[model samples]
Target: MFTIGLTDHLEGPPDRPSGEIFGEVADLVQLADRLGVRYAWFSEHHAHAHQGHLPTPLLLALHLAGQTQRIRLGTAIICLNLHHPLDVAEQVAVADVLTTGRMAVGFGSGSTPEESALFGSVVADDRERQTRFSEALRVIRSAWSGDWSGNVPHAFSVPPHRTLPVPAADLPGRCWVAVNSLGSARIAGDLGFNILFSHLRTPEQYRDYCAAYRAAGGEGLVAANRPVFVGPDDATAFARAEPALRTLWRRFRQEGKIPAETTEPANPEDLCGHPINFIVGGPETVARKLCELHEQSPFDVANVEVRWAGLSHERVCDSLRRLMEDVVPRIANAKSLTGRMPR
Candidate 1:
């Protein structure tokens, strides 16, 4: 099956009440659950008030688990280098127990210098950060198996004792590693973790990342994250999502994430020509784009972002409905006819 998943950074304006944002996310996940979305992923970001504000994904997953019946809840990533691996292992284990083993986790090295400073674990560079991340992940997996014994500096340290609240037996099967580099992808594969590719990458990049993962013996899922918004038709979808997309682009521009030479997109055509390829259209259009992506990269799951930059709760819910109820069936049909789905 061409499985589809949902991911959210819990983005909202600073002025918006946190409760409203969380409530809306809960509603979206519940909607997806009822509509048979395979997974619901939440991201973690610290002190990010207006954007990427959901700092505790496991907590949110536990909360959502009580509300929804079937959708598997996961951390799109937890910045493992910033916190104790033992603590994370404990929380993940508890979540598995309470959610009846419907929990998943994606671990990554922490990003941004400010976050590292705040966490009191400032790494010298990406290499050091990844080293720390590798160590932390090993400790976490060891703790899950109750066989932990290592003391990596600035990563983790403990005496000869098993961490409390052992994880579910199948928890490691659900572990993922968020990766932007081939080295990280290989590491994720070599360590028996699934791969979560960055949304910013192109299809060619996805192919290369998948190749690296497979070369390193990765046999688990390969998830590609992308912003997706579907509506009744192409024009309606573009019009509805463009404003929020503009808001997102402007913020990224201000943060130096977008090139200054790039102009704000005026319409769907402009968006198609822009650097970021957001999947914005009606059901058929969205479905076609996703199929094209799969044909190019051959991934296992489409981890989509349906909400962005102050987009309304109602609009998001509608998009999720169209995506799951409409777009997904089209993909499945295409796969059946063309045999394009990854084996």
Candidate 2:
């Protein structure tokens, strides 16, 4: 069946205590689960200045596994360079067991230079970072096997043994590697792993990315994610989303996180016009765009974000409700008419 997923920064303003923010995320997740969103993806960030909380997405996923019966738990990415692959494998295994095999994992090299510095990761250059990530992935997959080939390190020096609640033998097919470049996409394909690319890039980029993936033997899931907002109508959606969109853009620019060619867009219309990479519209409007996107890129899953720049939990839930109830079905129909429906 075709599937949809939701992702979040689990952001809190700098003023609030961290605990309250986490609590709010839990409650919001419960609401999303009830609304029938398929997957709950937590993003990773550490010591972000504006409070991009939830540094340990795995812990949050594990904590909610018991509470959420239907929603699968995921990490949009677990930065692999700094983490011990064995630890990552074991934790993911435990999460898989806890969620009854409901796990969709995404791995990445690293984020900003500061984040890499804090972790003491060897991000001297892109090649070095990719080397670290590639090795970590190898060790993680080895650690999940019955033989667990990563045992060489622990056996020689470290001394941890297999613990309780090992992962199921089979992981869900949706496991992914977060990719933004042609190289990452090519490697992800060669490794036979699925790839997750952001909507921040254009649909044309994704079309090229997917073609490269297929050429290199990638045969698993292909996911695309975007900052998305839906409302009762276009005017209301634009009004509610404008400030948040601008705020997010400004921060991205200041941090040098956005592409150099882009400027912070002040107009809501400009933000929604595909230049800024956000989907903001009424139900039908959003639906049409999603259809256009699937026709072009045909991502297996559209992992969307409803919470950004201090949107209220109720508002996020409402957006998800429309997404599930109205947008997704129309997208499917659009796919059929265009003869490019997702699997």
Candidate 3:
């Protein structure tokens, strides 16, 4: 069976206090730890009230590390282009130490032009952004390896400098690259970093990107992220999650994240079949959909998005519990016994 992990955006309504949102995230993570989930990741965003309010996911990870014992905690992604690689490297190193080597690092270029521009790193095109990302990653790797004294060849270069507090051993193996295109996938492969495929893409696209990564000699882990919600039954899950899905899709469409021509699904079954949608249903259905997803695009890890689009803390906790206690065990048992899904 594949590794099962949970992802949270830490998003809440504007009416609520940010403190309360953070508290709820902590509680959910603690509960997840108790439920024996393998990993938990938090997303990073800056000045986006409607999106995840968390500006520094690494900071949040440090906080969560103090509370949870078994579950690995990490940043879903840190916008590498927005900050100096030295600072980022130091922060990651300290967090790794504090978490006792249970910290994973995911890096990417900033998603939107607005957020990039806010940090004075304008995304004129993908090429420029990629250059910045590669350069920063090179430096971060160098620092973590304790060979920081060297001139890295890039527009952003460092000259024989060192960053304090080297990361825990084998940090590179724990590093991840958030892939949005074939180019990024190849880069991740070249750097020997894990590749995380976006939930926004279709299975075909995911397969294509994975092919590119493997072709580039990427020997690291492959992870797939998707929106997943579970409940006692299909109707209950659909009713609770559909509105949030609608709101999330509407916002994504407005922001041009998804193609305008793509139509939204009308029901739970349609969602499971849609090219760019999520998995939402009862335990059996959720388990089956997860198996289908693995068959469609094989991955070593499943990063399940359990909280988004202003889903309530209670709703998220119930879904997480069902996913961990009900859905995951069935998948595990089926895989162990027959090497295939039951349904």
Candidate 4:
């Protein structure tokens, strides 16, 4: 089965009250759930108004869980290095219980130096933070299974009592790591978790990640989180969406150089050879783009990002309906499963 989900960043002006965003998100999620979208993934970040307003995604997800049934709710990632892992374990466990086994989590070493500094010296550096994140997985799983030994890091003491909302047996297939490299993909696969990739990376990068993941015996499918905009036609769609895409370009424009050909774009129209990843088109074109993406990367799911990229509420809703009634049926027939991993 293939899965399609909606992911939003709640990116808006900081002055926008949290309640307004929450209500909008509830509506969006309800629409997605009713339309048979398999999962609703939310991102977690703190100290950044532009990236997302919701610092506590699990809380919002829990609220969403109350409003809908059957759709899987997830944190695309909760930065593990910044917070005590046990605190996260508690939150996820509660979310799991409330959602009745529908809670999926993605963990990451903190991403930026600025975000890292918010946590003081606990994170150390990228390598050290990654190490801590690696240890955190073990600690969290140990808490899940009611096992007290082996994986707990020495920095923290184990809880004497069994954690409530003990994880379901199939959690290995539910949790994920947001991967950007072959190495990270292999690590996630070796550790027995699903994987997430972003629109910024090329399909070739996805190919490398998937190959290494499969080499390491990964069972769960690789999923892509992409920004998508749809309209009545390609021109209208691109014209309406380019401004937001440009903003995204500037947002992701960072100090990094990797593959020589894929350097950051000089202008908004420059897609860095990844137009399909941005997903601007009519229904037919969008459907075709998804197929093309699957051809190269074989991703079983696409956690499509809307709203945050500045599409109007009306347009976002209309596009979502199009994705549901038009785009999805052409792509896959997957329904919301209780906890089954997409094949």
TM-score of the candidate numbered 1?
0.93
Better of 2 and 3 by lDDT: 3
Could you tell which candidate, 1 or 3, scores higher by TM-score?
1
Most TM-score-accurate candidate:
1
Best by lDDT: 1
Ten contiguous residues with the weakest lDDT in model 1 = 334-343
**TM-scores of all candidate predictions against the true structure:** 0.93, 0.89, 0.92, 0.87
lDDT of candidate 1 over 57-82, digit per residue (tens)? 88998999999998889898888877
Give all candidates' CA lDDT scores: 0.81, 0.75, 0.80, 0.74
If the candidates were sorted by their TM-score against the true structure, best first, what order would they fall in?
1, 3, 2, 4
**After superposing candidate 1, which stretches have Cα over 4 Å from the reference?**
149-155, 272-275, 336-343
Q: Over 4 Å off in model 4, which ranges?
A: 122-126, 155-161, 253-276, 333-343
Error of 4 at 6 (Å): 1.9
Lowest-sum lDDT 10-residue window in model 2: 149-158
Query: Which stretches of candidate 3 lie above 4 Å from their native place?
Result: 257-276, 336-343
What's the lDDT for residue 325 in model 1?
Answer: 89
Candidate 1 Cα lDDT to native: 0.81
Instruction: List runs of model 2 lying over 4 Å from the truth.
Output: 149-166, 257-266, 273-275, 335-343
Worst 10 residues of 3 by lDDT: 334-343
**Which digits, one per residue and each the tens of the lDDT, describe model 4 over residues 91-202?**
8887787778888778766556676677674547546655666778777777777556544677666756666667677765788888877667767887898888877688
